[model samples]
Target: MRRDILEHYKSTGTYTYAGPYSEYFKSLPDDIRQLGNLICSQVIHRVTLREGNSGANSDLRYGDMTRFPWYRLRCEDDVLMTAAAMTAELFRLDDRGFTFQRATENKIVVT
Candidate 1:
């Protein structure tokens, strides 16, 4: 799964979240971290499958998801977005100080 995820990013030129959230991510339980990675992989795969089935050209723009090959979940921006959302939901489930916020258009603040 990790290899596939790396290959997907390489082939698509999509960014992955490797920023300041590293510490927080590392602090997560092994199972949670694995699940997050898996979710991220699935998100990319599903989007690619949808685009391929839609018969549209794949778009590799920085932040466009309307056309084919959109970077909905294949870029750092989307990854952070998903992380923020997931953290918020998971925090509600278990108040574990795993907080993420979109500090800017392309930046994520994790705590």
Candidate 2:
């Protein structure tokens, strides 16, 4: 990862820019989609950096572990991390002069 990108994230509280993660983010259409893409990529990146590999489908703690049903149900931290990332992304957008409001029924997520 580039030092500048890290610094930018630390300072801005968002990867909502879609530049550094162009391969994934640019094609994602919205901040929420981009963030989800970013998080998935980070999981692979972080696991490889720490374990010297992506841990494939074996390690329950990182890598392609999310592919497992039990892993998704049991890994509690993932839920928190995702919520936090979404909040941060939204907050950063608000800070960037975007305003939000309550609306009618909407799909919060897709399965």
Candidate 3:
């Protein structure tokens, strides 16, 4: 079922959120939805999937989907992103923030 959706996205390079899949995805559990969000983002934004393991077979992108766990993400290159995330955590580099406006006498929101 999901594979058909993926194939459709791959073929058309278009994304739709209001179809039957929207409620279907909303009903899914958190962990699975995490991956689903990633897939949707990649499809809509055309983000390239990282080749995690240098020696991993490229043909085995989604291996053994019938199993409980998918190891595709486990094989991605995590070091650079992990370092950036750690630095962001250390520096509190979040995009959402607020500051006081002296002239308007109000708080300004940043996001």
Candidate 4:
């Protein structure tokens, strides 16, 4: 899966400009990237759950793994945000039948 994701990123140049966070995500080892992809695959859609009313009746959830510090260490907020943006862009690009080039060596502009 990691190889496939990397191949798609390379082939389509679908990189996201994550500022300093680009290095953090790009430098991740293959195993870690695979793990991240696995987690992301599980969360392709938005999820919400009802909570007993205590002022809050509903809660938005990404994934339970997101609450772990170790997961956060491996996938920082910036990285996750950028990934989400990139995924959205990927869908848009696919709809338009277009592929983009990387704007920089480390990242692709999110916009």
> Which number leads on lDDT?
1
Task: List the candidates' TM-scores in order.
Answer: 0.25, 0.20, 0.21, 0.26
Error of 2 at 46 (Å): 3.6
In candidate 2, how many Å is residue 40 off?
2.1
The residue ranges of model 3 lying beyond 4 angstroms of the native Cα positions read 1-14, 32-54, 58-61, 64-111
Q: What tens digits encode model 1's per-residue C-alpha lDDT throughout 1-92?
A: 69988887645212345344457766665786765653332222334443543434244222223432333234433444544454444444
Per-residue error for 86 in candidate 4, Å, reads: 9.4
Taking all chains together, the TM-score of candidate 4 against the true structure is 0.26
lDDT per model, in order? 0.39, 0.36, 0.29, 0.36
RMSD for each model, in Å, please? 12.5, 14.9, 18.8, 14.8
Enumerate clash totals for all models, in the order shown. Answer: 0, 0, 0, 1
